[model samples]
Target: MLYSDKAPDPVGLYPHARRVGNLLFLSGVGPRKKGSKDIPGVTLDNHGNIIAYDIEQQCHAVFENVRFILEASGARWENLVDVTVYLTNMKADFATFNKIYATYFKENQPCRTTVEVNALPTPIAIELKCIAAFEDK
Candidate 1:
């Protein structure tokens, strides 16, 4: 199990990542900054509902969070073998998210699945679940 002080605190009681054999499985990572509840690019209404969000920003932040977990687990970005993306509004956010994703994933094109969901546990617009493979040293 890995817990990263450089990554955001998980919403629930779960480690940032777990290593088994040569594979590292990361729990869902969001756009929130480390040690904070604030989600990047998200603007919440007075009632704590999402009023607006920038998908590009969230994508970058989530990717960074994933990186933090990977580093904590002694894995690299290129080691990612699979990725699952959760989006709150596919129609509004997919294109922006894809554009940003390409910049990070153009070389290491992992198997990816993106899905639209009603919402996340928080007001963030995007989250990522990832699996990575490392050599048994």
Candidate 2:
């Protein structure tokens, strides 16, 4: 079986959830509003936005955006088994990353790796991509 979801006015990416058999592959989600983009932050609504450039806040926002994807798929963070994080500067943000990560997955603790890169599309600090699964029977 296959599944998908699309929410207008809140995001540009639609069909956010994709299911292949028992596994669900989610796109890299970032915090953004319906008309605008996910620049960074918690205050982003229909019009206003908040810019969260700090590593801690940036990482948290990414995960919070991810949470929406997970929920759309009828799953939760705990359903995640593996994750890949891309960072523009790993050394400067390691501690902050671990701290915010714990708040989201302290118990589930998905297999993950943090890697440093040249940069992302935005000036924001980090981006996260994940894979989640469940029994398909």
Candidate 1 wrong stretches, greater than 4 Å: none
* Model 1 per-residue lDDT tens digits across residues 22-122: 98999999989987777888888899998888888899899999999999888999999999999989998899899899999989999999999998998
Off by over 4 Å in 2: 1-15, 41-52
**Residue-wise lDDT of candidate 2 within 1-137, one digit each (tens)?**
22223221223444566777768777655444334554554343454432335666667667766777777788888889888888877888888888878888878988898888886654556777688987566
User: Which window of 10 residues has the lowest lDDT sum in candidate 1?
Assistant: 34-43
Return the TM-score for each candidate structure: 0.96, 0.74
Full-model lDDT, candidate 2: 0.66
RMSD of each: 0.9, 5.0
Cα error, candidate 2, residue 102 (Å): 1.6
Clashes of 1: 0
